[model samples]
Target chain A: MESIQNLLIGFNDIFSVYNMIIIFLGSMFGTIVGALPGLGPSAGIALLIPLTFGMPVGSALSLLVGAYMGTMYGGRITAILINTPGDAPAIMTAQDGYPLMLQGKGGLALGISAFSSFIGGIFGLIVLVFGAPIVSKVAINFGPPEYFMLMVLGLSTITLLAGKSMSKAVMMALVGFALGMVGSDYVSGFVRFDFTPELIEGVDFVAIIIGLYGISEVFLNIENLVHLKMGKPSFKVKEFIPSISDIKKITMPTLRGSLIGTLIGILPGAGGTIATFLSYATEKKIAKNPEKFGNGAIEGLAAPEAANNASVPGALIPLITLGIPGSGGTAIMLGALIMYGLRPGPLLMVESGRLVWLMIAGLIIANVFLLFSNILLIPVFINIIRMIQKYLSPIVTVLCILGAYSLNYGMFNIWIVLIFGVLGYFMKKFDYPSGPLILSVVLAPLTENYFRQSIMLSRGSFSIFLTRPVSLGIILLLITIFAFSFIKKGRNSKNQDYSEE
Target chain B: MKLMERIFIIGMMIFSGLVIYEGIKLPIKSEYTIGPGFLPIVIGIGIFISSISCIVQSVYKYKKLDTDTKFISKEGATRLGIFIAVLTGALLLNEIFGLLISMVVFMIVILRYVEKYSWFVSIRVAIISNIIFYLIFEIWLRVPLPGINL
Candidate 1:
């Protein structure tokens, strides 16, 4: 009831035509910018902030928050249409979404993702409105040991991604971990692998992703002569709308994803990347037809998309309630709040309740606005691929090159993309799962830093992970997850044998 | 495929060995914390062990593995070569001509040769696409793409 009253108060502030138009245009522009390679939520928010400088604080916050939501929604566009994810969070989306595209259901993929993103956004906003103070308490209580366990939990999904050979996936993951460590050592500040001056900042994961998923995928498509499985442009209802059965299938997964995303997004640095990953893994594990995952399962497509969007509001809970930014986008929002003369700590909600509620209200409106806009624009988006199917290889190649180049405005990352492009080809040829490699690359340094910090805080005792209650609880959860997965795998193999007999 | 798998295993082992050597050369511990070398050392060992297991599994399955599986068609391989060449050549050309000229050249070459589009279609598409890319990245986004002066 209080949450409702606060939201109504927010709506009153942002109900005018000018603010409505601002929210609409901000989200629309953000969608385009975010869909392109080399731009993300942080870039989108940063670019829009100065433009909103002279506006009333309420209106400015609404526009920025709307764009923030738009960027998250936009990531799935490329990941579904092309195999390239705009960023790490969309990686799992591509695993299933792109496959659905290949199977000639690109329109359905876009629709399902948009709907899930909307549901997830609204769900997270509800939690943010009512649960922010409570959740903020939980988030701040997390220590290094708890964070270390969280990283472990994130890494444990590697086995789920292992295609057929566990050893090969482990090898790729280990390699990714090594590559991730190439930059400065967080503990001692020592440069371990400064083969080039670029090594000082570490291997750019975005460049590698562009190479591995984007460039390498273009290579494989050219080799296989199926650059995109773009069918004749069809404006049929089924192509753009989910059937009732499809909705029934995705409903539970979307809810599950929203729950997981809200819970995990509050953990700083463990934002949508891990949430989407864990959501995908959970759906895969409990799925009736687990094999359908990664091969265009609508559940697989919907769940991670939900988690990705939900993490936005989930990520904001800490920032609004406790002044802690959970992810890079929220970190910028933190700066924006500070610049607006707003203190972001515990006094934040008490001091600036209207502004925070306005932002939440803005996100709610943006989610609804983006759903209609993205869905209505589906034919236009998919038609671009259909109309230019012949020229896609070069176009995608150029985009990948530009994407890598835009990271640093130097030719260096472009070369990195090319090198990894060839490497990615072979990895695919030999059936190596790129997921583990990418996941390990993202988490390796963070995990190491957390482990080191935990050790230091515990006076060099390694038992801190087990001694802390939350950390110990995470270990048990990991144990349960792994145990159940192994049991299910054993049972499945036995079933296969029985069928054969 | 079998031979390539063996080579990949050897390459991983070598990579793991280098990581171990580099790790040993770096300090193992810093005051009150594990040093920078510790994680790399552990990861190196992890890779080494995993590589060994993969090698054993490969060797044990060598007899049963099919060496003659059709990996890719001949024409497919040829197209792949041309595609990669065009991509790299475009980047090299970017150093001289910048992103526009290089990519325009890339579009024409790829469309005309690889996709086997006619010269009329190829050149037209090439110019139009580069213009759109330029207006978006260089003009709108202000990316300062290579060789914008040209």
Candidate 2:
């Protein structure tokens, strides 16, 4: 009953005129931004964050959350229509979605994606609401040792799950840590790498984010501009509705994907891309007609779409509860939360229950709006895509500059953007993952602070971390994951050598 | 790709060594507890080890590396170079001329020459986008962007 009352209060807060308008506009804007190739949710949120500066915390959060959800659904549009994924996670959707579009069932594909995303989003939210509190309760008992171990686990998991190579991921994450160490130390008040006055305050998270994701993406897209192609989409509005058979085929896959996504999302560093790929592979393996997948199969479209959307809320679970972001989008959101003067962690729920619930309610409301608006505004979105496609690169470049500048109203931030932009481009060129780098930058201060505090608490005894059961468990888990990756790599290389002969 | 990979590994190893060098200058232990430099030293060591491992792996997989190209083509490399030069020019322009003027010039150059769009379309995009940016950032959001007095 109390939970029901809290939810009602949350809804009431979200339904206010200003908040509702913000959510609506944010959703529309996010959808358009997501439909644009090369701009994913992280870049979208980072670019638009400066606009929310003067707004109330609740209103700002509602707008961001709305956009966050909108991007998840909006990414499907280009994936299905143009055969080009608007975001990384949407790549899976494009495999089957484009085939469906080629068959002139583009409307059905869009409709199925929207519907599956809605179902997955709602399911994920339900899990978040229930799971977050339990996670927080468990985390509340953690001291410095456990906190340090948890951060280590977070960094390790992100490294392990980053991509094909574990070494590159570790190298990238270490670079982030190195960058994070540039500022004044929190405990001792000693500046480590302050070669310039600008470095004294630390590298601005927003500057790095805009540079790495937004500016670098522009550079990459510009490099490929010669071969860029935008597909022409044709679909009748009346054909948007999926048939009974299509719905029946997708229902089980959608549910399973949502479940899988939600579970994966709860794990640190396991994000939407992983969730979507895992669910898609699972669906393919379990399907009676697995050959139909990647050839306009509804199951392929539904599973990944569902998993990607579900993973958003799943990613939020760690962010809100533990102050640890599971994905890049949530990491940006965490940056936003910090900007708003709210410390996200176990105490966040206790100190700001109303705001927390309001954000949760805002997500649910946004998903509901997305369900209807995505269908009704499909034509509008398509039209917007055609209009905006030509000017995307220049517009993004301008936004990246302005976004970085607006963070501190300084030219130095712009330089930071340029430097990191080149760095990010090279990283991408080298097949090095950028996700772990951002994650490490975000988590570095907390990890360092906790490590120092834990050691101090133990009177310089390092064994204190192993003495705590929870910390010990996390340490063991990290070691096991590392060992597993090592063994697997060895086996694969051995197999490769055998095959070579 | 092999050369680039070798350069990257060597560069990272040198960078890690520099970090360790600087980190050691800071207090490693302060008041009988871990100091600020401890984590950086640890991270630097980790990077050194990882880069070494990367070098070893690259050596073992030399045949595979031969297939990878750092750039699409020499022309593509020139284009990227031009892009960077233009961006740096824009940054300098932003400092001297301000955001609005620099952005407009930047957009026109990028749209017209880089993207090969027609002059008319490029100017139209530049003007319209600048106006929208001004209205949104300056008027609505109240961001104090560097701009003309007007």
Residues B21-93 of candidate 1: C-alpha lDDT, one tens digit per residue: 8888898888777988887799999999999999888786677665646667898899999988887888787
How close is every model to the real structure, measured as TM-score?
Answer: 0.70, 0.94
Off by over 4 Å in 2: A226-228, A231-233, A491-501, B65-72
Give the Å error, residue A383, model 2: 2.4
lDDT of 2 by residue, A1-501 (tens): 555677778898878888998888888878887877777788778777877878899999999999998888888898998788888889999999999988989899999999999999999999988887778888887788888887787677665456878888889889888887888887798988777898988999888888898888888877877332555545666687788998999999999999998998887777888899999999999999999999999999999999999998999998888787877788789878877888788777778878888999999999998988888789888877777777777888888888777778888998999989988887877788887888788788878888888988988898998899998898888888888878988898799889998
Candidate 1 contains a number of clashing pairs equal to: 0
Best by lDDT: 2
lDDT of 1 by residue, A155-238 (tens): 666666566777988898899899989988756778987889988998877677667765776677778776445444455545
Best by DockQ: 2
For model 2, report the TM-score of its A chain. Answer: 0.94
